[model samples]
Target: MPVIEVDGLVKRYRDVTAVDDVSLHVEQGQIYALLGLNGAGKTTLIRMLLGMITPTAGSVSVLGAAVTAGARSAWARTGYLVEAPVAYPELTVRENLELVRRLRRLPGGTDEVIERLALAPYAERRARTLSLGNLQRLALAKALIHAPDLLILDEPVNGLDPAGVVEIRTLLAGLAHQHGTTVLLSSHLLAEVARLATRIGILHHGRLLAEQHADQLDQHRRRHLHLGTRDDTAAERVLQAHGYHPHPAPGGGLQLTDEHALARPDQVATVLVQAGVPPTRLLTEEEDLEAYFLRIVGADHG
Candidate 1:
């Protein structure tokens, strides 16, 4: 069995279908990111997986055990931090971690977990007194307290400063690499997920649109040349002449696909020059995971 498996998982809330027949697998020692906008059912699906809520239909199994109501033991082997974070505001950072250790019956290693998350600097500070970034670090420390085999984090870096984002990213990478923790990370930050996730699953309107290896997703949206000239009409004409369909760009540039399109950028430069257009700038734009997601899920809202 895979580390985590969702088979036709379905969850409904009142008149709305929060999760609709979704299914995916998370293997051991891999970071799988679930990418989606708000209300895309990612949270609901996560809740079902953690056994916090039961699916209206379908099933979820983690570590070969079915996820059902009151299955606290199943989740005992897992660690998690939800999007908004759940921490004891009055308790100090170290106190919160100590609580988690005792709750999990861990062998008194809160210090090691705090060190792993780099939370020693503010260990004695009240959770409510810490900044947003520091609070996030404390939350992560709590999650790692038991040294779980599986880690589930939703928006782990949300509201963090640039340095905080990098710190969290590095910490998660270390956990996955050094400790061999299988992670299920959910986020709307496609760029961050692309950097850390081994595989990605795109969710749209409570349904999964696509799943692919991070490298494959990157390759699909490879860099292409964007040609901007004095005359948009003439530039489009020239690119079309070369069997290139120019994707529309907001900042007044004709977007083309493939690195091969710009293999001889000088050729297009010459064409524009001969046509008396005088090429303004030739920029290469690499396709990122966000670009691939927008392409697959589209830019329009339902």
Candidate 2:
């Protein structure tokens, strides 16, 4: 069975609909990422999944159990980092984790997690004194302290620097690949998610616009052949004569979306050179994830 499941989920706040008819599933050991802009209901959907908020319509199931308020069993095997990390201002890092250990009745000491998250240096430091990056790490440590079977994170790397971001990514990937832990995370960082997530779901205007396997992203990406020559008009004319439609690119080059042209850029170079317009630049460009995301969202709004 899928580790996480949402069926026709909907949430309404008075007259405003926050999420509408959304449904998705996450299997064990898979990293599923939800991408969207601010105010796109990503947080609201996550809240419903964690049973923090009741959905107006639809159902959520985690670990083969229905998600509802006070579903202790379901929550016991789950770990989450939602929004900003919060800690008692006066509590030291180690003390905060110790508190979580006792509250969750977890059967382990805080030493392992402290080392795992590289918090030993600041273990005795007060939460109030930690930097934003360390505070984010503390939140992650809390979520991972119990070694839960599932993790649901919202912008887990928000306050992290480049190295910190890479560290957390490796940790999450290890958990999923080595331990079969399922992860569902939301992030606005398209490139980061593209690197870590096995699948990606795009949300917009409080709705799911698209969902696709991350590995298949390249296949769905639009590819174009870029050609440049000393004589732009001649190159364009040559392409047209060969029944290929060319468009002007922003960088004073010609772009062709024809499948045959994209497939055989070498042929394009040959044609251009044979026409005495020897190509100055000939390359095939595949749209990156960020560009693809913007294109998709733009089309949705258009």
Candidate 1 on 28-106: residue-level lDDT in tens? Answer: 8899999998888888888888888889999888988988877765677888988686789999988888888887787
Clashes of each: 0, 0
Q: The CA-based lDDT of model 1 is what?
A: 0.83
Q: How far does residue 268 in candidate 2 sit from its true spot (Å)? A: 0.8
Candidate 2 regions exceeding 4 Å error are 299-302
Candidate 1 regions off by >4 Å? Answer: 222-224, 229-260, 270-280, 287-291, 300-302
| Per-model lDDT | 0.83, 0.93
lDDT of 2: 0.93
Root-mean-square deviation per candidate: 2.8, 1.5
Quote each prediction's TM-score: 0.87, 0.96
* Colliding residue pairs in candidate 1: none
